[model samples]
Target: MFLLWFLACGLVDAEGEPRIEAHRCAAGYYPENSATGCAKALEAGFGTLEFDLVLTRDDVAVIHHDPFVNPEICTLADGTRLGEEEADRVYFKDITAAEARAGYLCGGIEVEDFPTQALVDEPIMTWAELLDMIEGHPDVYLHIDIKWEGDLSRPPDTYARVVMEEFWARELPNDYYVSAEYPEPLQEVEKLDSSVVTSWSWPSFPDGESTTLVAIGHELQTTLGTEDLVQLANDAKVDELNIPWQVADRRRVEDAVASGLPIQLWTLNTAAGLEAFGKWPVEALITDYPAGDAP
Candidate 1:
């Protein structure tokens, strides 16, 4: 308990800003997403929730990281032949929005298997559903990641318009944020809403990177000094930058702090890594696993 507070207190960015954020509490893991994920994350007292949003063939919102149903968490109704992996057999492409709602088994054979998880028999969540959830939880910060490019094979402005319009309609927490791996799609979001009120994914770093180690490669190429990143984004006139902590350098981290743009590091789940990012200029963080101790 003391350690969490001390670590939290030690975080200071350039100009002495503080950076800290909860990972994917909104997207429950081990048990997959459920009410449990949402409930527990709320209990952990996170300032923001990072969640991935995907679409079904029926055009419904499904909160998942991947396009397929991982067999580790899914099974046939009973007669369908099992495959090497669940993902191989079950895909969002095959499942309609209706089918997703019937029931789902994620990561384990049964919900009871993972007691800590939210085991739900409902279909995957849709965008409207997620938005409604967010509306209800006004206090939580939303770090929404758009998982669809809109056209699947290509891109669609609808992806941004739909989500962004709804966000504005609900007048969700001003602290809430949005990001996307597809910069093109994100550009749409930026164009639609240019206010400085929202938060973004991560910072865009420059230089060159090596593929030697994924992490090392990121450090070499994607990571930059925080200040430089701010200039890059501002010069480009973009709204947000989703950066990986592994790739961010002190200059990049510090610049983000001074600029007042929300900073969120990626995939951090370790105590050491969390502590390290906390010490930087980051304003928020995205981790795969919630430390649960929630700062």
Candidate 2:
């Protein structure tokens, strides 16, 4: 109870609504411009934050989706990318994680999603920094999708769990949800903190670990199929089912609901689809649109 109250104190601010984070602070707009887009998300009363985590050349954690500099947002101010076409020259692999941070201005450094996004020039921060951001806003919950480098040298989930232990050891509030496609990584996360909700990501890997949304026909088996995963999540005390938005019609969504699993569609933008999919109960969703960032 004391912990809860302490956190609640951080939630109250001059503004009545909590600053629920929606999209990553797109690489563009920030406080100087109109705060309408992202700020409105906060104002709309969503208290959970979602963003991608990338490793800098230094191996420091940064908030980015791609392992390489995105051509879509690459600019010359940070580094020489000849043209947007030259983004391939800047593949994150070419540089160490450290160099990646030094090389590019991140987050609001490029084309911004909202006028509210502040242009950040510093290197991407460590996962620790991401946690600190969440901790500061006591009332805010987080839905962080794990970003793997695809090196296959080490499991991405394992690296994340170690950092997560730091958060847990600090007695950080259990207000965030983590999802990953790697089996070993996701399982490792379960060992690290079972109470912290976990989600099975798709495109099932070698061990078939990340296949959260498997075919319905394959669900009724002892094997590690989609059905098994749904049960595993439930047995492991996971909270919801997260699937790609294009997982097909409402009938599938309705079946998932019938099983008592709430659907959380990934990386959606338009509101029209959301309204249409509203027929089924959606526990959460990941969207690029900060305009309607509220859950």
Give all TM-scores, in the order shown: 0.70, 0.64
Which tens-of-lDDT digit does each residue in 1-295 have in candidate 1? Answer: 9999889785554345343445445343434444446456667666677666666665555666555655555555442334754335555655776786564644335544334544543345566666665665767777777765333412435666766775677766646666765555567777776663333443322213333455564455544433356665665455656677656666655656567655666766566777666666666566645554322
Give candidate 1's total backbone clashes: 24
List lDDT for all candidates, in order: 0.56, 0.51
lDDT of 1: 0.56
What lDDT does model 2 reach? 0.51
Name the lDDT value of residue 223 in candidate 1: 45
TM-score winner among the candidates? Answer: 1
